[model samples]
Target: MNRKVIITCALTGAGDTTGRSEHVPVTPQQIAESGIAAAKAGATVVHVHVRDPETGQGSRETAFYVEAVDRIRESGVDVIINTTAGMGGDLYLDPHDPTTFVEGTDLVSGVERLKHVEKVMPDICTLDCGSLNFGEGSLVYVSTPDMLREGAKRIQDLGVRCEMEIFDTGHLWFANTLVEEGLIDAPPLYQLCMDIPYGAPADSSLLASMVAQLPEGAHWASFALGRMQFPWVAQSVLLGGHVRVGLEDNLYLSKGVKATNAQLADRAKTIVEAMGSSVATPDEAREMLNLRPRS
Candidate 1:
């Protein structure tokens, strides 16, 4: 066997894709069920983000995470849980008034975003490296250096691994800074988010360059949006990193076909295996990422 690749299935995201695809999980029960289904389909980890049941928008509620995580644990499925601490940073400014915060803006302090992570204490939680133009609009996903340092310290104190989310090269630089400052624990993990609008483009050369910049002993994964999701699996593995896929970054298994979280994980498993790399089990993934032993 070549390398054992860990596959993470991101169940539901905070994107506006809920109406676009009926398969996007909206409620806490659905999120937990999707995670369980993905785990059974050979996913080593499940990245979770809760949505408001009434509005289907992403929420920062601690109770939602508590229930979702508890349900996953109660199901007895063996899979690592990775929750998103990237919420509460969405800032949508009015195009007319640049200084004014708009209705879509959800900006909050770095510590505020980790309320769910604090409550559930997942195996891993994401810490977006920096702010960036979030799409083809006035929305900017803000994560300042101060916010990052604070969040990194909080996550470090929790003993949960922080999976630094890298949207661009500059974000990668700041992530390395956090590592250098000793805020991040050993075996730092990175998630290279590609093709998400104004962030890093989905280019193999860029991915290679980014991987080369990772710190020694760092565990990493790369993912792209929509059509590139599965192809990037091969791209990430070839670069000696892991892989992530699911309804969060993508909504389809193929063109015009909506996908469930399980379907996406199964496809990723096939791609990783076809490349002569075996998929890591949950325990194997815990070892690879240096996660704290399950409590």
Candidate 2:
């Protein structure tokens, strides 16, 4: 087992989880504070996503990202900032009229999606490898090959690390193809996203299989949503992969109890130490992931 594992804390995701958990940060200040807290709690990286402060709804605003990143930077937190470039791909098709797009659909081009990342130049940004049936009904997370190539190239050009997000086995194959095409840089970074509906389930067998499929010399982390968050932390380390934990993926520390991002990071750190693995610091994580420092 790899003793030096990096922990990434997903501070606030652009999901419908505000009302469900009060600890989910909504404003830029709150998000920055949560990120700093996670870093202090042993997370080497902070994966961030902004929301509409007033409504607590997910947004794709550059101003929100700028504010959040500024706050985190000003706070002098020694953690790698990993922004979300996975937005602007939601496609909710109409059930009755399949040809027509639904109201909540926010389909955007690849260039539009990377605007924030380009402007802020965060140390790392997410690039979802492939599309999948996001949830029940006609909802789908659309990430086409052309779009993926465009996003990957842009992130590479900006000199920011792209954290390839894989939700299923097919996604892993597609990511490997990117490496073959030279779109993804050497020593690729991957996040094995599990437990999402219609994606790879959060099971030890499945996690092991996914880990085995990763390209040689690739740095990777694995996380599960909701209740599986803590368990998957140990499971990932056991499988020779890193770990991620936060309110973005899971809201509860236990049954019917909500957890903040700092709490989640602390819990994951506890598990990693218990397994005889030491947590990687931000500088070590930057070197391992091949991320450039912000200017």
Candidate 3:
């Protein structure tokens, strides 16, 4: 097993998790502070997703991203910033009237989604590789091949590292296609998202099968939602992959035990060290991932 593993803390996801866990940061200040705390707790990178301050719902507002990034940079933390460019692809179609889009639908062109990333130029940006059945009943996250190609092109043009997010096995095929098409840069990075409904399940066999499909020389990490979050850290490390943990993916230290982002990072760090593996610092991670050094 690789002893030096990079840990990424997904501070807050674009989900309705704030109501469930009081520790999930909602505002720009809270999100930025949580990022800093995670960095100090041994997270080399922070995966960010902004939410509406009032409703606590996920949003793709440029102002929110600007404020969050500014606060994190100003805090003097040494964590690599990775913003979500996977929003604006949610397709909530009406069940009866498929032709009519739902109220929550935030469908936009792939290029539009990268607007914030173009402006902020974070160390890394995520590109969700494919569409999948989100939860149940007609709800789907649409990421067509054309859209993925377009997004990958824009991300590459910005000179930012793209963290390809694979939700299923087919998504990995699409990511490999992007690499073949030269849309993604060399030494690709991937995030194996597991245990989301209708996607790849969080299990050893499935994780191993997914890991085995990774392209050669690719840097990757894996995370599972809810209870599987911490356990996957050890599983990923054992499979020669990196680990990601935070309140976004999970908010509990145990059954009914609430946890903050920093606390989660600390717990993951302890597990990594106990497994005879060390956490990679921000600078070291940058080097390994070939990311542009943080200014």
Each model's TM-score, in the order given? Answer: 0.98, 0.98, 0.98
Q: Compute the lDDT for candidate 2.
A: 0.91
Name the best candidate (by lDDT). 1
Per-residue accuracy of model 1 over 69-153 as CA lDDT, tens digit each:
9999999999999999999998899899999999988889999999989899999999999999988879999999999999999
In model 3, which regions exceed 4 Å deviation? none
Where is the poorest 10-residue window by lDDT in model 2?
286-295
Minimal lDDT window, size 10, model 1: 1-10
Which pairs clash in model 1? none
* Residue 127 displacement in candidate 2 (angstroms): 0.4
Stretches of candidate 2 above 4 Å error?
A: none
Screening candidate 3 with a backbone cut-off below 3 angstroms (N, C-alpha, C), the clashing residue pairs are none
Compare candidates 1 and 2 on lDDT and give the better one: 1
What tens digits encode model 2's per-residue C-alpha lDDT throughout 51-92? Answer: 998899889999999999999989987888999998999999
TM-score of 3: 0.98
Mind giving the per-residue lDDT tens digits that candidate 3 earns over 99-163? 88887788888889999998888999999999998997776898899988989999998999999
Distance from true position, residue 237, model 1, in Å? 0.7
Candidate 3 C-alpha RMSD relative to the actual structure: 0.9
